[model samples]
Target: MRDGIPRFVPEDNYGKSFGYQWNLHRLTQLDSYVGLPVSRDRLLRESGWTTDELEGREVLECGSGAGRFTEVLCQTGAAVTSFDISNAVEANATSNGRFAGLRLLQASIYDLPLMDESFDYLVCLGVIQHTPDVERAFKTIFRYLRPGGKFCIDVYAAIVAYPHLRQLLRPVTKRIPPGKLYGVVQSITPRLLPVSTRLSAVPWVGDYLTRLVPVANHRHLGLSDTETVRTWSVLDTFDWLSPQFERPQPRRRLERWCRDLRLSEFEIERIRGLYVVRGTK
Candidate 1:
């Protein structure tokens, strides 16, 4: 660590877009806003783990942007090692710092600081797809799990058409400065939100129409508050638009990774354009 702060080679940090976006919406996705811990629910559903399964477990949560899911993991009474490749971990630290079962680190998935076979469970959500190399990232994360240790990962589905538009727009949008791109998304999100909501209601063709738009439509994500929706709309849209790399991977590819690594009892499924993979080492 340089000057008492972790210093990564500039090339390894590919999450400046995420850092910019999450700092503003640090607590927006947490359960405190609504009576439901939706983030927690998503984790449990994706990993096929019950509440009791997480208690006292040692979990390594990679790409823990803004600590949304970090809070959920900590709430499970588990010792969580959360890391992100951006300054967003600062927001994570501020919000979840008081928890005794938490350890926060700012590190890239490709080059994490932890030792091999050091964790009981490894979770990398909303992350692998955004990495420069999905397969390599998967291999690297797999090295952290102990023999028979379990892991759950979620990434954008490679076959999904929604991401095609983002890929089309990213060449130009990603070139724009983070602040400027954020400004562009912030101003247009409110207007596009209503358009997205209206078009999403058009019967048979609504979902496709909504997907055609470049903005993220959270209408069907089970989110309920207006302000929360609006905030998430902007943040998630910027998320889709601003990433340097956003390659969605297919279930087959994930299964291939598991097979190549000789992982046992692995399961891969797609849910709402996201591929969820759970496996045992």
Candidate 2:
């Protein structure tokens, strides 16, 4: 098992509970990236690729935090295997149980316990950078995908963003607890106002009421609803804590990597602040 919080999936033998709020309603709201202009339900529409592209194909998704997209992939006739490092996703498994073809496995990207060349389509989004090593993780995932299979992914690009600016605030921000720190950050950041943030936005109220708060300006810009706000509050804080910008692989660089791995036909779509790289093995 990978070294991390006690909630690490591989170490959790029971899988009875993951002690996190990860329901379908909550997950669909936390995100708006990947397949831009398209919601998670509109995956094929936005990416210009559909599950019909690989009818009845075996699929795999790494870092299936809440299996929101996993549900969509399975609905499209793909056999989907979703994996994550946290037992916290046990709730995700339960929530997604309606999809019989969907499978939830507890594992990490660096040490995926799967038979080589077992999948025809692979997806690892919003992950990789948080791992011990990115290259190693990519190589490991590549081994599981069969030749001619496609891999679609979205990750933080190296481009500079004010969110990264949160790092500078971390010095003072870190002094407080994670929950409280997130709240303070949320208040100053106006984007978090309309919707209520769960973990990150909760503690700020206490601090604000008691006058222990620090700063507030960042707005809750993207997330529209309360559930979306909470999920974003928890996740964005996690991103701020472990921001890893890994992207913009020159087409040649990515092409060579794909070639070495027997993956072909590389294409990249640049979204507002990130990149969605799609290629075939």
Per-residue C-alpha lDDT of model 1 across residues 121-171, encoded as one tens digit per residue? 999899988889989998898888889898999888877844356667888
lDDT of 2 at 161: 33
**TM-score for candidate 2:** 0.67
Q: What residue runs in model 2 are displaced by over 4 Å at the alpha carbon?
A: 1-38, 45-47, 161-163, 170-238, 242-256
The number of the candidate with the highest lDDT is: 1
lDDT string, candidate 2, 1-281, tens digits: 32222233445332111223243234433233322222453355335567576558898888776665676776677788788775645656655667778777666666666899999888877666555565666678888888887787665555423334454654554345444544555455345333322323566453233112222212334434544444455555543442233233333444455567665686766654445678776
List RMSD in Å for every model shown: 2.0, 8.6
